[model samples]
Target: MRSDPLIAVEHVSREVTDSTGTLTILHDIDVALPARQSTAIVGASGSGKSTLLAIIAGLDRPTRGTVRLDGVDLFALDEDARAAVRAQRLGFVFQSFQLLGHLSALENVMLPLELLGRGDARARATEMLGRVGLGARLHHHPRTLSGGEQQRVALARAFVVEPQVLLADEPTGSLDHATGETVMALMFEMNREAGTTLLLVTHDRGIAARCDRQLHIEAGRLKPAA
Candidate 1:
């Protein structure tokens, strides 16, 4: 069975003004990302891939057009309401691991569930950590763990929510090749098992190939069907 798209981007563009004047970061972009599938955005530096992802995740606004999440117009909502929708529907994993140095692996994973008032936060987080092979390191802080361990904890936190959408930005960029491969494999496995829609921005073609489809970008424009 085919599910309706979880996200729809329609003619979106972004521009920023600096001392050098206005710079166009993204041209008009349109795409539909179906639920429970993974799509990768690949491009060179300054290609606006991350910008597009941020816009889709409602972290950034477009100068033109709008994005819809599960048929709800993102820009149509007020900031707080949009934030609420984003928090409820989306999860993220980043190259930097983005974990708190002060929080242990289990605590970091439990934070999101706690934010949502889930009483089973500790139990769910513990299970997720075990799933990612981090059960023994549950009490280790990000600074105390290796890079791969931190990323695994990040993956656990991301999947713990079973979010409707997962957005990853260069998730392997900061790791060694061997560790990167392991993390990516685990991320795919988690995404698949949770039936979450994934939108990843990556520079590596191999990583892009892991996705269900690839959207190629060049000069701030998407190349059709890559």
Candidate 2:
């Protein structure tokens, strides 16, 4: 991992208004994740872990403060510009394995590359599917694959772009224990091989333990991990 931080969060906070009143979902948070390192964000349900992840990924905006990804101030850009940066530099893996059910594995993996206008989209997608051990299942739809297989396809699609950072939210939350373990193992293996910085939000202590560092959040404040 490089000495420089790949992601920087400075004095960040978030709030939402409900019928009751304004509620703070995150407090003044400061975090720095080094390049090519793995960090886990751990907290209980509704502790703002997911909220933080979304802000980091540029999927949502924080009410206050700034987020810099590889020296680029994310919120400084307009939505379209931010999206372009995300497509080029970030990969996301969701717990639910968000694949288009109507598309085959190959097609699903090809979508991003296609959107980016890569001429060799088919070849790259095919190669990625093979890496995830889904070479033979390229034509299979998500519904036909096992949960592990579906997640593997999701992994392939995420890494196919060779993103600088990989962000995951409860990646194994929906799987059985054994399958979740297997998927996580593959995730780490691929992370190592690709030298991608990994920032994952997970409630599982075992998963958090595998990361280089763990950030514990409680009541929207970043706390030292127990």
Candidate 3:
């Protein structure tokens, strides 16, 4: 069965002003993200891929246009409201593996569940860590884990919420090729099993090919890659 699109970006544009002048980062972008499918955004540096992803994911607002996620207009929501929506329906994995350095792997995953006021957070977190093949490393802090392991922990924390939408920014940006492939495969497998909509910004061609659709950014414009 086909499900409704989890995210929609319509004529979105982003611009920033610095001491030098105004810089247009993304120009007139449009895309649809259907549930249970993966889509990748690819481009070189300064292509505005990450900027567009940030706008679509509600981490940053667009200079113009609209973003709808799970039927909610993101721009209409206040910051706090948007945060609430994120907590309830969105999950994110970033290139930097933004885990708390002091928190154990399991505790990191449990944090999101706690935000949702869901009990059994520890149990669910442990299960998520195991799913990421980090069963024995659950008690380790982010600094103690390998780069790949930290990313996996980030993935676990994101998926622990079973979010309706998952946004990843260059998920494998820092890993070696083999480790990157492993982590990417795990991401796809979990997304498939959970039927979560995925929107990933990546420079890796192999990663892009695995997605259901591809959107490429060039000169601040979004286009279907030839």
Candidate 4:
């Protein structure tokens, strides 16, 4: 792993306006994550774990401070530049699987590579699907697959690009315990092989325990691990 921090969140906070007044979703937070390390953001629902993840991924801006990815201040870049950085360096997995229902598994996995203008999108996506144990289901659509299988497809899509950082939000939240376990195992195995920085938001302590470090959030305030 790299000695320098791959991701740095400094005094970050977020607030939004509601019907009555400003609602703060996150308080001042500071965190630095090393390259190739797996870290879990653990908290109850509405504690701003997802919000923090979004800020780090450059999908959302922080209200108070800056987020640095690979030593570049994310918020300093223009929107298009930030998006380009995200496209090239970050991969995301969500709880809902986020697969296009009409596209086949192979197509879904190939989309990222296509977006990045890779000429060998199909072949690369096929190899990724096979690696995720979905070789036989490449032609199947998301609706035709089981929850576990759908998540596998999502994983293939995220990992196909060989991103520098992988951000997953409740990746197994929609599956049964056994199936979730299997999916998570594959995810970690792939992360280890790729040596990508893994940061995930999860409510399951069991899952959090499997990561290298766990950071807790309570009512939008970040608390260091004990």
Candidate ranking under lDDT, highest first, comes to: 4, 2, 1, 3
Query: TM-score of the candidate numbered 2?
Result: 0.98
Name the better of 1 and 3 by TM-score.
Answer: 1
Pick by lDDT: 1 or 3, better one:
1
User: What are the runs in model 1 whose C-alpha is more than 4 Å off?
Assistant: 1-3
Put down candidate 1 lDDT per residue, 1-226, tens digits, no spaces. 6666779899998999989899888888988888888999999988999899899988999999999998999999888988888778899999899998999999999999998889999999999999999989999999999999999999999888889999999999999999999999999988888889999999999999889999999988989882
Using Cα atoms with residue i matched to residue i, what is each candidate's TM-score against the true structure?
A: 0.97, 0.98, 0.96, 0.97
TM-score of 1: 0.97
What clash pairs does model 4 have?
none
**Candidate 2 positional error at 57, Å:** 0.5
lDDT of 3 by residue, 157-186 (tens): 999999988999999988998999999999
Candidate 3 residue-wise lDDT at 10? 86
Could you report the Cα RMSD, in angstroms, for every candidate shown? Answer: 1.1, 1.1, 1.3, 1.1
lDDT of all predictions: 0.92, 0.95, 0.91, 0.95
Give the worst 10-residue stretch by lDDT in candidate 2.
1-10
Work out how many backbone clashes candidate 3 has.
0
Q: Which pairs clash (backbone N, Cα, C closer than 3 Å) in model 1?
A: none
